[model samples]
Target: MLIGSLLDEINKKIQELMGKYVILDAYYIRLAVYKAMNLQGTRKDSSITFMVDDVFYVLQKCIRRGISSLNTDCICTVINHANNILLTEYTEALKKNLSASNWTAVSQHLLQGELNNVSGRVQSENAQKKYITHLNDVESSTSCIIILHNESSEILQKMYLSDPPKRLKVLSCLEAFLQTAKFFDSLLSETLLKTCSTIFYKLVDNMLQGLLDLRYVISDEELLMTEVNDPFMHAFCDGLKQVMQPFKKYMTDTNYAKLCRILMPYIARSYEKVVMQMKFNYNGALRLDKDVQYLLSFLTNLTGISVRNKFYRVLQITCLLTFEKAEEAKEFLLIESDTERWPFTNKEAREILTLRTDYSEEIEQLL
Candidate 1:
């Protein structure tokens, strides 16, 4: 019999007996119920399989409560069997019932289920299962809880503070940094971009500082002033700049300068790749005069170079001199146009060439 139906039958019997007996003892009543249930299902020494289709089915329904007492010896065994039988049905029901409010619970439960490894974890098994479950429950449906992060950070901190190896700590710090960033993105206000920037900078600072024990981590002080190469650093710097772009409308000159100072590291880091790409190849050889002049001036000032004198020959032919001289100078400087081959594609390559030539001419004029 169904557990619900059995429960209903037991409740009815209890009601009827309550009205019949003047001094009905609770213990005797309970024992009578257990005995009646046991008679319906054969009580084997190994396992208790309650037969629901037995005769006197109405009275045998009392076995529902006795199952608990009977489970004392083989509760795990019963749970295993019960779980095995109900697992499929439970998951199907859960899938149909999932919603945004309960996504977090579903994600957690699914993760735990994966860890249990009932469905084996192959190369992509864990990732694929997690991907499917996450996509279905959170990503695609937008109706499930987002597991932005787990307990990875807490575990990392404890490991680091104790006696973690240097290599292990570095990796842990990197993972923690990424996880914390993701967590903040999911939780923080969208308008609080600067707030996120500050947090991001702090994380970078922490990561760099953590590597201080390594010789290579402490780079040359001059190298710090040099342009950056890491794309992540560039992105971080750009993000800060974008966040503070609107501040000038409200900020005082002094406040703006202060903000710029705060953003300098980010800007420099982010601008490094662009600067290097510009130095490589610039195709706007004869046009973009103003842009070229600006780039030259900017580079000269930043690099402490008097481009007017340092690169006078190279710039002169590229701008004021003959086309032949310009061609010769380009060859001298190994200035091959990066976009010459990928004319129809490579948007970034085109932009770089345009910037590079302008900057090159500006530097020549300044020199």
Candidate 2:
């Protein structure tokens, strides 16, 4: 009975020390999490900020200290506090800065690396760096959350809980950071949408469609003379390379892929809209087919994603416009292409055929 009393006293003192430890560290944990969002002194290099590393390093230290007591409750205490700090101080600061960046106006009608007069946000080099750094911060935070979770789980596996179920119970507390990761993901996508879509569409409007839509397809001879690699397209390719360079340098590969998925569909829709509006003779259709192929090649090579599916309608239009026989086009559409996946109906294909200036009356009879 005397030994039992002394054991109780020791456990009670351990609990007290754990409480004091968490209380003492809470202030610094919050401080470290908040300081991670110090946008003002953030790196201008657009790399992942050291602040992210610092925040997690501090958390690791805190977790190490908290777990030394061998009390699961103590570990839970530290984790809950860190989770609160991340969801509140860290996430709120990111959201607040993103809100003020006027993300919606960041890339309005940017062409030839120049912002249109209507664009409120100037695309200054420094501003772009800062914006990219903010994006990188978000991505790094998300990535670090996964790394930290794995690290925490491993620490538990080896040191804290030998049983998998109990280990997972403790790890369940770590899932809170997954919510933070998801929030950062939404922010990253939102920023990319606000900036990249307009920038790319402007490149299309000025570089690709500007040349195609200029009423230059008046005669067959000029259409035949139109080289696949027009100076305008070359310029568009160069401009596209310039547009993609910064993203490659700064964005995580996963987010960079997200950036491409965001842009490609918008670009495809833009291409399809422009192609539908233009008058295409036989030579014009032939030249445009090559031009589309060229563009698809460049973008596919750059992004390493098969974007041909996105431009499916554009390809169908080109096929209908350039096909020598109506029956062959019908067979191709119904048999060669997947019926459910065909972007256009027979009626739509007929409508596209009407855009062909040099087409005979029978071209519309494909259906």
CA lDDT scores, all candidates in order: 0.33, 0.72
Worst 10 residues of 1 by lDDT: 140-149
lDDT for 167 (candidate 2): 69
In candidate 1, stretches whose alpha carbon ends up further than 4 angstroms from where it belongs are 1-245, 264-269, 278-282, 285-367
User: Please, what are the lDDT tens digits per residue for candidate 1 over residues 252-337?
Assistant: 33334433444344433433333323222222232223323544464444333344443332343334322324344344334433
lDDT of 1: 0.33
Q: Which candidate is the best by lDDT?
A: 2
- Best by the TM-score measure: 2
What's the residue-level lDDT of 219 in candidate 2? Answer: 62
Instruction: Tell me the tens digit of each residue's lDDT in model 2 across 163-248.
Output: 67666667788777687778778888887886765566666666656755455344666774566336655677787887677677
Off by more than 4 A, model 2: 39-46, 97-123, 160-165, 202-212, 215-220, 363-366
Worst 10-residue lDDT window for candidate 2 reads: 116-125
TM-score of each: 0.18, 0.85
